[model samples]
Target: MNAPGHVLVVGASAAGLSTAEALRRKGFGGRLTLIGAEPEPPYDRPPLSKQVLSGAWEPTRAQLRTKEVLDALDAEFLLGDPAAALDVERRSVSTASGTTVSADAVVVATGITARTLPGQSGLRGVHVVRTVADSLALRSALLKARRVVVVGDGVLGAETAATARLMGLEVCVVGPQPAPMTGQLGPFVAGHLAALHTGNGVGLRTGVLLDALLSQDGAVTGVRLSDGEEVAADVVVAAIGCSPCTDWLAGSGLDLDDGVVCDAHCRAAEGVWAVGDVARWHHQGLGRLLRLENRTNATEQALAVAGNILGEDRPYLPVPYFWSDQFDVRLQVFGVPSAENTVEVVEGDPAEGRFVVRYDGPRGPVGVLGWRMPKQARLHRAGLVDHYTQPLEPTAP
Candidate 1:
């Protein structure tokens, strides 16, 4: 509570590193220990599915903290060792390597792992892009395959399909959702994305269930849909998304909903805080606990938690910004635009590869989504950060 006797951070990803920095910036010059499951130091993950998988970038290229920052902050870095369990009563944690650590305050930012297809483990040419290892595996498979089948239409899946297309590997995307990014950008914007991917030589099939993998000699060869339709493929990638890495928190007494349930200030329980995908934090605007698996949510919550630890009263309210790079088009969204609402096409055109869509709820101006027109998306993000309670003044009635 009082600048923390010692700060222990679990997970050396964006959220963990950001928390350490936020604490130091606020003059919390106490002991800082950061641990991660990966062998590498704290790094960014947004590029893992894009440039890193495309072979144009490396994981270290996405590092959020430099060696100087780590040293100056007096933070201990524990690489290749994951925090296995929390000893809440003792204010300590047990690591996978049998290491124990105790602190006055602990931040849990373990995040989530990729979800794979049901019967994909035995198949040789199957991959899921969530970590550096996953990206490397998928890249290798893409290089050797003549054709690839991608399941799920989330951000990572679409990006993988786009990367495969860039590498000249024919790709087909199968998803039950009507459009890509439907949960964030809403269905109207997602419908336009469906057209974009379809027009780009990537077969976009919506409302289909990718049930099973067809294999020959324990290697992936094709996929069978729930509709009894079989698709030929040299490789299959299941990007159905992620599951929170909170299995170890079972019976820990911390509220565990979809993730480690926390308050607006990122407080999980008595002496713990939750940040990133591992946190189900209360969003005042949405009036519910939200577990956002994105860089934006992770970084913001980390800062909020650090500040709160240092006796700050500011509650974290993220503006909600996310973007995706598929082929050459960049889709950006800024707000919680419910997919069930009516949409008003604002500017640009999806057919021309650039546009902005405004989601209209019963009260009006629920959210905004855009593709290619980055400047437009930025304007919407500014509105959100500025907390635009009402729609912008309409001109000339």
Candidate 2:
């Protein structure tokens, strides 16, 4: 495999597209092919649950509208076809159409798949908001839905519930965690979020697993709660989580625990590398290997991997960040905040639905998360570093 050889990219999300663009910018004129499972082109996914649900944005607008960019990059588009398997030994990828494309370097950007609940097989009004198709389906259902049962209170579930409430549908969220968004925001902030939703006419049930999807005549009617209870619903949306789309990498030598294991260079196993949601890449600066199921990470990791593929030596070390727009609140997060992490009120107030929480490591501020304060978060994003200390308040703007 040479520096400029046949480069096959699987998945057409942020990662794949960014990597292809980066490769071209790095002067790579290799045979490039980008494969996607969706019929639509690579689109921004954050709006699928919010603006698209409110009919403010259309599905067509979400696509990566840089056709000229891709054309100039000289990359072939293979939309709606998924990579079936990776023949790592032969350095080739097999597509669903039985087409095996031989390549010198392969970048897997297969993203993630939405996890569905048991007995939720029959779908008519039941939905998951991970893809454009899923959001479009749920938006149509919300037009007539009176109540919604959202299983899992992650950012996706919370956003869907908020959207349902905005659409005048009564919403209820059921999750196994004690508080909403605890996985990302921790207990203190999730408590405030839970309170916000419940106050806005949302029924939130924590620590309850989903039992079954109630259906009659092959159309979803309601949901049966795990603890012998039922939620009245015309729509049931499961926002449990996503599974890494590395099923095609099975038997490949790529280190796969939860996803394709890679270093900061995004090198997985042998001539193969992975990025985006399907990659668990090591960050040299952080001294830890982690995977981010975020658009920002997907873009950054893809570019960094592309640079490595083009013979650059820099390792990926980006500030992990993600955001959510729900109801009247705009949420932004930087770094991972666990339950044990010391949380301090860095700016604003939680009561006002605006605040920035700083997570302190043993040495100093390791991460910062905020809501409705883009300006502060922007400044704090640059301020945070390993062994960096942030005072309770900034030095006056």
What is candidate 1's lDDT per residue for 1-397, written digit by digit as tens?
4567898999888998899988888888789999899987777888888888888986678777778867887889888998888977767888999999999988888999888788877679988888888888888878889999999888888888888888888889998887876876677777777777887899877788887899999988899888888989998888898998888777777888788999878898777998988999877665567788888877888889888988896677777778888877887777777777788767887667788877767655666777899898677555454343232334474
lDDT of 2 by residue, 1-397 (tens): 3595789899898899888988888889878999998888789888888888778887778877667765777788888888998988788888898888888888999999999878777668878888898889889989987888899889999988998898898899999888888877888888888888988899998888888888888888887777878887888998999999988888776788788889767898677889899999777666667888988988888888898888786777777888887677787888766677888988999877788888877656677888798778767876565432222232355
Error of model 1, residue 311, in angstroms: 1.0
Best by lDDT: 2
Give residue 237's lDDT in candidate 2 (0 to 100).
90
Judged by lDDT against the true structure, how good is candidate 1?
0.82
Q: How far is candidate 2 from the true structure (C-alpha RMSD, Å)?
A: 4.7
Q: What TM-score, computed on C-alpha atoms, does each candidate reach?
A: 0.94, 0.94
Per-candidate local distance difference test: 0.82, 0.83
Instruction: Give the per-residue Cα lDDT of candidate 1 at 258.
Output: 81
TM-score, prediction 2:
0.94
